[model samples]
Target: MGDKVISERLVGTSTVHGRTLEVHRLTWRDAPGLSYDVVDGATGELLTVDESFDEVPRLDQLCELLEAQQKIGTSSPRP
Candidate 1:
């Protein structure tokens, strides 16, 4: 079978640039590590999928990712 999802839990919520985001922790049975996803609280859109952590990431790390996501979203598109 393909990689089965082991768990997915909402860590908490964080506000970045006046927008609220839902942070989630995702683990897979076949994967050696876990990942974190940031979703927009209002629109329920997935923003970031970061698989760089082998363990539970700290809140500050999630916040940093959110900040970076916000910056990318607000940047002007190149022609």
Candidate 2:
């Protein structure tokens, strides 16, 4: 889907195979809800996140690991 870019940033970085692995979270327009991507740092590949729920300030929630984001997802999406 071709969605507008709202925000993107480096969540963290790590050393993998002697290369800098940058963890990222990219948010795109998804109509009423937003679409986010968790890409692999080293290869810039998409990581699968099996989550779907209404949450506002989604960026903050996506910034953390999957385990840490469990508690959030009942709010509303941002405009």
Candidate 3:
């Protein structure tokens, strides 16, 4: 299934106990539904499953947090 990015946003530290979050929007044709997945990227591990759009919002929130953490880990440390 072809995946397309629909929307993305950042979850501020205030919402994540002092951590930033990166929320992504994806659309797939085969599934024909809204879903979210969290990947380690560093290890290529699938941290989470394909969550449906209607259930709970936790998946989306978690993904956002993961993305934020990844960004922080990859960027150069401030002196």
Give a tens-digit lDDT track for model 3, residues 1-79.
Answer: 3465454332221234344323334566555555544444334444344342332247456656456555665332211
Model 2 compared with the native: what TM-score?
0.37
Better of 1 and 2 by TM-score: 1
List where candidate 2 sits over 4 angstroms from the true fold.
31-79
Q: What is the alpha-carbon lDDT for the whole of candidate 2?
A: 0.44
- In the range 11-42, model 1's lDDT, one tens digit per residue, is 77877667787777778898767776667788
CA lDDT of each candidate? 0.65, 0.44, 0.42
lDDT of 2 at 49: 44
TM-score of each: 0.60, 0.37, 0.34
| Candidate 3 Cα outliers beyond 4 Å, as residue runs | 1-14, 37-79
Q: Write down the RMSD of all candidates, one decimal each.
A: 6.0, 9.8, 9.0
RMSD of 1: 6.0
TM-score-better candidate, 1 vs 3: 1
